[model samples]
Every structure is written in C-alpha cells, then in structure tokens.
Target: MLQGKPLLGVTLVITATLLFAINDATNKYLLVSYDVPLVAAIRNIVHAILMIAILGPYQGHRLVQSTRPGLVIIRSVCLTVGTLFAGLALQLMPIAETTAIIYLSPIIVVLLARPILGESIGIVGWLAALGGFAGVVLIARPGGGLDPLGVIFALCNVGATVSYYLLTRILAKSERTLTLLFYSALIGAILFGLAMPWFWFGAMPSNFEIILFLSLGVTAGLGHFCFTAANRYAPASVLAPMTYSHLLWAGILGWLVFGQLPDSWGLAGMLVIAAAGVAVALRTRFARR
Candidate 1:
C-alpha cells in the first residue's frame, strides 16, 4: 500500500526533524550553563509534568495497559542513552559535524532490523544501504568532519538510535502512542535521576536559565510526539535515513543562533548526504510497489 501514507509519513517526519533541530538549538544553549545529566534530568522532569497537563487525567491509562512492559522498558533505556550520547557529543564536537555523523543511525537500523524485526532484505535494499553509507563518507570527507572522540560518540548515537527503533517496532504491534510516550518519559526520568550521582555537580540556576532548562523537557516531548506518530505509518527503516534533515537545519541553526557555519566543503558534502538519503527513500517507495 503505497497509498500516500509513506508520503505523508515523509512530510510529517521532516516536520518532526525540524522541531528536533530547533530543540537542539535550545539544548545546546543550555549546555553552557548546566552539566549533561542535569540538562537531561530537567528535560524529562518538565516533560513528565507537561504530558500530565496536556493529556489531563489518565486518558492513556488503558493504552498503557496494552503495552508489553518489557519492550517499553527497553525503549526508555535506549532513549536515555541516545540523549546522553548526543549531549556528550554536542559538548565535544561542532553541532553540524555531530549531527552529520549521527545520521549513520539509519544505516545501522537497516542492518539490524532484518533479524530484530524479521524483515527481508533484497539486492536493492543492499544497494541503497551502501549508497547511504557512501553518503556518510562524503559528508565526513576525511580531512574534514569531526574529531575522533566526536566520531565515536556520534557512532554511539547511531547504536542507541538503532536500539530505540528496534524497541519501537517491538511495541508497534500492541501499544498506543500516548502510552508509549508516557512510559518512555517516565522511565527516562527515573534513569536520568539515578545517573545524577555520578556527575552531579551544579549550582542552582537563575530564574531565566531555569526556564530554558525546563524547555529541555518541553521540546523533547513535542519532538517525540512527531517521532512516534511517524513510526505508526512507516517503519523505522523507512524513516531512519530521512532524519538527516537534521544536518541541513543544524547548519542554519548553528549559524543563525550560534553565529557559526561550516565551510563550503562541509556544506557541499552535507548536501550530498541529504540528497542521498532522500534518493534512497524515494527508491524504497518505488520498490515497494
């Protein structure tokens, strides 16, 4: 059923990416004022509260009832890990470079989904996957991209994202969207709080900074909404590569908000990566029929 669903999924997925890119702007802003764990904690804490306000009284209760408790737990852990790695990489690498390297998650997801999701692969799938991988090389361009530690964390970001996608597919069969989100945030908040003791160094924030810290949760909560919604109509393997939309927007956001931009070589490389991802998505759509 190519029935416009994936097309809608693509559009909605890009919207979600833009939201995430904007959220990244807010998050990188907070990094200067806060430790990584605390930044993560504040986001989840505010998100849990915001969800309560928006959903208003246990409407998703039964939806939660429908979920497999085990998979939900896994989903939550992967999300926290992904966020942690992202924050760490953000601290270590340029925002644009980190975002580009993390685009490898789609490639990882395609590799993992076969056994994990019991999906079949064909020659075309392999070809597209290789094309996507090649695109990563172009974006990095050896003498360019990110530092070694930055590459490792970005690759770890790919690993965490793959795990998150696997968990999402596991839950796709039985859980409701609101329930998935509610439990994911609930679990993430708990784990983040627990991790605080290892890295807990901070002064209490000023009132103004406090507000941005709280947006930590708000933007993530909103981005996850768009993310989860996309998963319902399209598989992670389908939506995964499309997330490179982050790279282009990150450059713009990095410049407009942070007063930084990549050199022409980096921009040219990123354009190829983004175009490669889109081409594969379009090819997949055609191959589906």
Candidate 2:
C-alpha cells in the first residue's frame, strides 16, 4: 500500500500549482505574438511528444490502452476544450482574473455532481457554491478590468474542466493514470493539429518565443505529473486546499509579467472564491473523517 505522506503531497501540490501558473503566464505571453489556435496546437503537440518520450520506454503501447475508451476520449476532448478556452481567455484577460474564474470549476463540480454523479450536497455545500458564483460576478462585473469575451471564455473553461473532473472520477476506477494522461495529450494534439493549418501564419517566432511555447508543454506535463504523484501520497482532501496556492502564483505572475493588478472588487472576489473553495474542501474532508 502507498504510505500516507501529507507533507510530501502538500509540497508537490504547491509545486504543481506554481508550475501551472508559470505555464499560464508564458502562454499568455506567447499569445501576444501568435494566434490562439496556433499557440494551442504547438503546445499540445509538444506535450504529446513529451508524453511519448517519457512514458514510452516503460509503458510502451500500454499507455494507449483504456478499459473505458469512450469515456477516455470524452474526457480528453473536455480537457482540450478547457485548455484552449483558458489560453484564449488568458490572451484577452489578466491572469489573476482568469485564474479566479477558472477556480470556479470545483464549485461547478459540486453543483453538477448532484445531477450527473447522483452525489449529495448539503446546505453548506450549496452555500459555498453560491458564494463562489457571487465571487465570479464580482470579478467579472463592470470596472473589474476583465473583457466580456474573456469572461465568456473563462466560463467555458470552467464548464469544460468540470466535465473533465467528473469523467476523471468515473474513469479512475477502471483506467491507469498514465493511460488517461496519454489520451489527453494525444487527443489534444491530434485535434489541434487538424485545426492549426487554418490558423497558421507564416511569421517566424523569436528564439525566446519558441522557448516559451516549449515551456508551456513542459510545465503542463510536469505539473500534472506532480499533482498525480501528490495524490498517491495523500488523499484529494489533503491536496485540494493546497491548490489555492495557484491564485497566489497567479497574482504574482500577473503583476510581474503584465504589471496588471486586480481592482479592489476583483481582489475581494478572488478572496471570496478562494475562501468558499477551501471551506468546501475542508467540509468534505472532515465529513469523510
């Protein structure tokens, strides 16, 4: 049996969050110079290549095998949509606001679980979900420095990610983690590749831009790997709260990279959403206890 290692798990979760934040920042930076689809396609292609190079030696063809192939493909498509939407949102919005909006995925999952997974949410869960939605409105409201289109994209990302998480929960019982990971990368790469030629521009990117695009794949793959590894050491209850650290990283990146800061309302909104998410995570954790 795997040993419980909360400390290691927490460390890994925080590391993964930081890496993901960096990936978002770099992706946003790249979007200033490349079309959304082109950037997304390159990132997914690099991710798929890395997945094969890293997992192929040991897992070989097993990486592609899935007991629930249909669910796996749906999950992959959901992830692809989430990634693309997030990239497009980041292209148009501040990282802090975008990250805060995407954070609503957990709340969305709670609301969705009832109908989809037949899971029950108590009064507190309902309140927490409401609080998260309120926070989203506060952040997206007028004078919040967020573009309307970006808000739409972020909301779409939340929807896609909620679906992705739900599928992950159902598929985890029958699928290998590596297999799921491989399918996500492979499906994203293939789908995005097919769409890239239409969005392709002949302009060559600088060496630095190329490196940033490459780093997106590295950060994405490694961040997910660390998160998966973290869960092996500690239950989701222990790692979920640590994910809030992503907001901190997002704030810092937003300020450092783009010199953009969320207004008072936006900051308050982010805090509320973070608070609600932590409350829900802790409630579920102790409830299981």
Top model number, lDDT = 2
| lDDT of model number 1 | 0.73
Best by TM-score: 2
Worst ten-residue run, lDDT, model 1? 1-10
Q: Which stretches of candidate 2 lie over 4 Å from their true place?
A: 1-3
Tens-place lDDT per residue, model 1, 166-270, is 777678778877887887787777888787677656576788887777777877888878776776677655786677778878888888988877777666656
Note the residue pairs that clash in candidate 1: 43-217
TM per prediction: 0.84, 0.97
**Per-residue alpha-carbon lDDT of model 2 for 1-289, expressed as tens digits?**
2538889999999999999999889988888887877888888899889989888999987999888899999999999999889988998999999999999999878888888989878887899899999999999997766789999999999999999999998998999998998899889999989999998787888888888888888998999899889988898888898999999999999999899999999999999999999988987898898
Relative to the unseen true structure, what is the Cα RMSD of model 2?
A: 1.1
Off by over 4 Å in 1: 1-12, 56-60, 139-142, 197-200, 228-243
Model 1 residue 184 lDDT score: 75
